[model samples]
Target: MQQEFLPQMSSATAFIDLSGLVNLFDFETKAAQAMSNLAYEYVVSGAADELTLRWNRQALDNLKLNQTVLTDVTKPDTRVTLFGHELLYPILIAPTAYHGIMHPEAELATARGASAASATYVVSSFTTTPLEKIADTATQPLWFQLYVRDDREFTKDLVQKAQALGFQALCVTVDTPVGGVRNREQRINFGLPADVVAPYMLAPGPQKNPLTWKDIEWLQSLVDIPVLVKGIMNPNDAELAIQAGVSGVIVSNHGGRNLDTVPATIEVLPYIAERINGRVPVLMDGGIRRGTDVVKAIALGAKAVLIGKPICYGLACAGAPGVARVLTILREELELAMILLGKASVPAIDRSVLWEKPDN
Candidate 1:
């Protein structure tokens, strides 16, 4: 039997108190309470049966930490360097579209929050706010997440504009050639409100021509900034991305929103990392809910990790402060995890920190 869509309290009727929210899930709970059923489903639902979505979190939980004790636990470093910039933490805000649905301030508020947390903010091409406006609000480094438009001229122009607007790198999303079969959204008959629209999307329909490796080469030829391929799940694809002169690769299945039964990003990180062999930075997103997850990812071979829904929850609840709080909790938790693991810095984390089951 098919399950019916359940309606939640409207954002207008719900009130949020950010002070009481202690963790990512806390914010998620509040955000769900404070959003319309349409909005919440848009943010939370995964593709089809959401098998990959559930697995993304479960796989991270299945890995047991091999904690160390009796070491100098003082001054644990959580800093990491990527693309010539020193990030205070290995955590970054994964790009999600249409922030206006969550808050009136939209991506401007997100930029401010990411700056306050000193985290890199990756603005989506489908951003509600203008790229220039987001750049103006950001104090920290910014990266642009691009969805190549069918119109070649517009895509080229957008990349040039992002470079001119001070976006440090290009994260070209490759997994979503077409919209996914989002059952939850379909059940709810969800659509963005007329008032909220993606300003960068000048044309009206879905992209008819999906991007290819040649497009990666074309983008590289057009700009000097580092280009990263997002949505890499296979080891061979990761190698191909490296050979295509990508500066980095994000191991993502579009946050489990593209395909339903694919392996979680965490499950594939090691293989992808191995295939890349340190040629370029390997980052992953999907199912990062705790600091321990961050530790596990680094130990397994992720140079950094990105969070998508958590940031939306924050934005929905308290705007910039909400976003800042989310980053702060993750940062503090990461420090504590490092101290407990006896690893002083992000680079010190390796597979040794994971507990492997003995052969039967």
Candidate 2:
């Protein structure tokens, strides 16, 4: 019933195989080429030390989902619900801005794929399309990803706008207080608009101050939607997020873009999950290249998982269809894993299926 293009089982498609046919293309590399062709570099490169970014992917791949035996796997399922909203699959797209840099259709196409696939769309604060227009096109729910505006009033206004537009939740991206130190951008002297660009809130300048919990509280007070803290990795940070009255926590190291040499998101999920004690749902992103990776993440206690670079990769090659293709592979692969593992539903997966890494 789902429409897609899985490139024929040749050199390209064979690389990813059914194990991960959709992600066989390199959206990140293809995108870099497009950006370099378009003279856009500041937004994609990682900050100095770049080690953390590389590790996020490696750490995830290194984690093996210890497969289990013949329980009644006659009918497996992969549906998940988070923040009181149901997601057809546990994988959701991680918010990335400036989609126009990668595809002509950009965010509009992304919204279409996410909508069609029944996955949650976390609209970026710096999205190319206006929030209302994107929300208007959605066949599914929306989550507004917030980047604090110049002042409390301006930030409040953006939150109000998202709420009025019917975005179901607000995910506050906190790790990027100051933009990452991208030496590549410095080498080329690339920079964003010298002034403000957030169309939703006509605030001024590159925001100089970082938002604190007090500011987070202010945001929570202004909107009725549940607030989620994104870009957190450490368990200590997770504890603080719970106390802040936030509804969820997305454990991330900014896909290794923000801090260099931090723990891979996968390496940290268990500790964070243990700390939260299910008080709030824990979601994670970074280096999720396989369906088994999704299985490992939820089994380790991620309420759901998000994909960064991968969707962008698909966009570079095929626009909306590319993103849809990526999600399709992940969804099908997740279902197959569930079927093989005897899980009729996603929530039934747990630690019993995981094997402790000899290395970990």
Candidate 3:
């Protein structure tokens, strides 16, 4: 329990109210040093040109909100339903790997945070904790993220196992046919820490099969659960995902870790949303730091936005309590934004609330 953020923290806390444990930032900054170069890099790595990674934040800066005044928004219902499950809020914990490296608590802690925030947790395929156990720990619904595995049999087995354990959906990450070109993590020669090896990695590397629309079909065949393609940047691919009967598509560039000199996700989302045209839900993840960013993403046609990094940063600082604190900030910030904008329900948000910045 830590409560030193004060005044700014006080106003911020008022949004949804979580204090006494507000120093998740400071804790992560210190935790970064404790981690070996490899562990640190693996978690924090970004790509070449690093421009896309940075732009995730910068592009969000270009958009302006058309705040409505004097509307009756006394109670905003943040509840949203996606992939067949109704969530308390639209926020989902983006799949990040090997939480144990950052803290002993690992994914278990994250599950606790998402549960606390009433947000969904998307567990990474390469998780340090066993997936089933993480699912058991979750108080809220859990989704699974799949890396392209080299073994089709193994992939099928993984999906079956996830469903057996009650995961609600599968998010297949496609941006990394190969892992992202994380220059920072590279500089550190990021590798698994001795104490933090992923048990699943012992199985074998990902199947070298070239993923395509065909793979999506195969994936749908493997399970009854909803399938979401997680790395779509191109509208054509978005269309294909819709045709393949995916329940949703997430617009991500592996958090800008895979490509260099690419446009930020925010730069690509609106067009992708238009192409999909509501056939399948379109979700965005990458550079989302503010509640206003969530609003911007929703108006640009995101069904919901995924959050990464910040929760990990919070975890590095204080474990489950830290992550819960971070989510509190985001939720509060969003609630405040919704209230101020004179909106009362998540569905009420749409393109009308945003004005696009001309690409400079």
Each model's number of backbone clashes?
0, 1, 5
Candidate 3 accuracy as lDDT: 0.79
TM-score of each: 0.94, 0.87, 0.89
Candidate 3 lDDT by residue in tens digits, 55-157: 8989998888877889988678887888667876678899998898777778888887777767788998888999878888887889999976677787889
lDDT of each: 0.88, 0.76, 0.79
Q: Which of the two, 1 or 2, has more lDDT? A: 1
Ranking by lDDT: 1, 3, 2
- Ranked by TM-score, top first: 1, 3, 2
Q: Give the 10-residue window scoring lowest on summed lDDT in candidate 2.
A: 8-17
Candidate 2, residues 1-360, lDDT tens digits: the string is: 234443223232233323333354455555465444333454446668788877877887776666667776765767787767777789988888767666666677788777767778888887877887888877778888888856767678788999999999999988877667677767886534433243553443456666788777878999999999998888888888888889999998887777788888889999999999999889999888778788888888998999867777776655665667778878877787777767778899897667775785
Per-residue alpha-carbon lDDT of candidate 1 for residues 59-79, written as tens digits (9 for 90 to 100) = 999999998899887788788
List candidate 1 segments past 4 Å from native: 1-16, 202-207, 358-360
TM-score attained by model 1 = 0.94
Candidate 2 — which residues are off by over 4 angstroms?
A: 1-21, 24-44, 191-209, 357-360
Best by TM-score: 1
Residue pairs in steric clash, candidate 3?
A: 2-20, 38-190, 149-207, 150-206, 150-207
The lowest-lDDT stretch of 10 consecutive residues in candidate 1 is 1-10
